[model samples]
Target: MSFADHTIRVRVPGTSANCGPGFDAIGLACTVYNDLELTLKKEAGVKITISGEGAANIPCDGRNIVWRSVQYLLRKAGLLDQYPGAVIHMENNVPLSRGLGSSATAIVAGLKAANVLIGNRFNRRELLQFATDIEGHPDNVAPAIFGGFTVSTVTRGDVECFSFLPKFRMKLIVAVPDFPLSTRKARAVLPAQVPMADAVNNISRASMLVAALCKGNEKFLRNVFDDALHQPYRAKLIPGMYDVFAAARKAGALGANLSGAGPCLIAYALERRHCEEAVGEAMKAAFRQHDVEAKILIMDLDTRGAHIVK
Candidate 1:
């Protein structure tokens, strides 16, 4: 579980947190990924290289989330004081600040790198807790660490989560608009309080959504994603958000949802995979009506979260 040499590469999957009604609780990991490679240096200095997504905007220094996460894990493990310098290289595919859990990938990658470098003193459970602590929530981090489907929460200042291998094999179609929606800005639009009716509605739908996914019941799934919680308030930020959902459904999607404080919309399919193209086109057309271009990605669930490549 440990490497004597300070060179290792790790891959972490991209994550989409909150599948409609399960806000800050459910996270789904996709096949898209971010890879991080670290080589220990003899001298006390670090070097970094970045490609893809926010490569131009992201920092290549200690300020980078990946780098900061590396240091954070090392410190927590009591290895920082004696740490050697390391060069970190990131090959990123997940879009930053687009609600695809880019930051969660970076955090998981860093922790995995450090664990392997130090002989993996921590187990996956420990690593997941550490990652959740770093990310300040388990939604994205939990799935990024455990992959597949995850349900997570913080209980009494501690992280509690579990992963599930879904009974249904679902195809995910993610359509991202040209514009970005920061989680901060999206949260700002929501009212501080909601009516008891709205709260009850989300709870009912969330329960049904979980049941549908577990039983592979597409009939129940079709109507289960109607969330009355976060989406309605945040839809104002993304032009045509609801329209895109409508379009995807019209194109044969079993259910459609805003992917985590999105400008990204994700849909599940139960019918012909050929309908993926139709759904993608429909979503894109909806975005174009608002003058925003978009990208539609077709992916399956990632069964594995983060792992090292020898």
Candidate 2:
């Protein structure tokens, strides 16, 4: 069998999941990104090299998540036997384990790159399903694949994603703490169940949030981000988490929330307000009060999710 030797490069955006009260059902893609370049080889094994964020810790073997994802797609497409080797390079900009969906970037990149190599046999929806299967949820992966803001639900082993780009512009001010919080540790702290009243609170707020964001109704957005589901329980893990949110709001941010299973926190502000710097500074000062140092990134939404670079 003869095949063309070409490198498929994929760039995928970082994502923030569970925006406010939506839990694992909501996410948005940010401008930060990770790039993966996959070149099918005539050899028989995979070679991976990683640079930038988490490079020291991320594996370079077949155990690498990116390679595993590539293999997963190839196996599904019955091309594993035909293409037994690949050379993959990952250049990462998204911070690892910082609630910014870095892992999803890797997964989405690998899947998309492999699919392109196979002549794009799968569409975005099929790619979403494969990503969800690997991620165990669609929150991060949905937005990573489709960009913009995504609301996702998994039903009977199938994933459904509805994505939208906000009609209005806004600043996503992320305060990434120096320390990383593993998603596993954050989820372990959540209680098995919550009171019915708390459940109702989250439901109403989550619904309002989606509508407000979609409609670009800033008035409706204010005060709708309060969560009864996970934030309170996870608060203890992140010192001064509530204080940070309060400070951002006080500093002119419209709303704020824990970014995914987070030590990182995100705030929303109108882009035209030109108050992003102030919001970021307030969040930073608040974290400093808790003896934690954080890096601030004032990012905008990335509407182009994952795409080939070459």
Candidate 3:
């Protein structure tokens, strides 16, 4: 096997899941991304190259998630024995274990690369199913594959995704703290059973959040963003969670919530200037109050989903 074989490159966007009340169901794609370049050869071997964030931590062998995703698809397509050799070059911009869907992006990129390498045997939906199967959830994977604001639900071993292009002007400000919280650890803190009141509260808020977004009712968001299901328990993990939320609100954000598990807060607003200023100031204040450093980023909703970048 040599490097000069059929090659394909894929760029997949990072995603923020949950989006306040829409726990484990809704997600939005952001501008952050991970790039994967895969080459296939006739021989039977696998090599992986990694760079950027988590390059030192992520495995550069068959154990990598990207490599596993490609192998999964190839095996499913009954072409596992056809190509014995592969070299995967991964450039990751999304942070790992930070709830930015870094793993999901890598999985999506690998599936896309495998599809191209195998002569496009599967379409986007099929690839999405493969990714979802590996990720065990469709929230992040759905938006990473379909883009924009995606509403996804998995039922009866099937994943359904619906996307809506945001008509109103908005900015997404993400505040990432210096500390990191593992999703597994965060999940462990949640109780196995919740009170009926908690369930009903989340349901109402989730519905209002969706309605506000679809109808572009910014005012509805102020109260609609409230979540009693996960945020209350998870907030204990992030020291600055409440302060960040308050800062975002005071700084002109329509609503703010924990991005994914914890440690990262997302503020939404219609004005770019307000979003930038408010997000920045809020992040700084929150970090200072918590005695932790932070980074603030402003990005718009990514309408274009996964596609070849040539």
| Candidate 1 structure quality by residue, lDDT tens digits, 275-298 | 888888999999899888999998
Candidate 2 displacement at residue 253 in angstroms? 0.5
Q: Each candidate: what lDDT? A: 0.85, 0.93, 0.83
Better of 2 and 3 by lDDT: 2
Of 1 and 2, the candidate ranking higher by lDDT: 2
**Model 2: per-residue lDDT, tens digit, 128-245?**
9999999999999999999999999999989999999887998999999999999999999999999999999989999998898888788999988899999999999999999999
In terms of TM-score, how similar is model 1 to the real structure? 0.95
Model 2 worst lDDT run, 10 consecutive residues: 1-10
Ranking by lDDT: 2, 1, 3
**TM-score to native of every candidate shown:** 0.95, 0.98, 0.95
Could you say which candidate leads in lDDT?
A: 2
| Residue 124, model 2, lDDT | 97
Instruction: Identify the superior model by TM-score, candidate 1 or candidate 2.
Output: 2
Q: Write the per-residue lDDT of candidate 3 for residues 90-110, one digit (tens) a residue.
A: 888888888888888988998
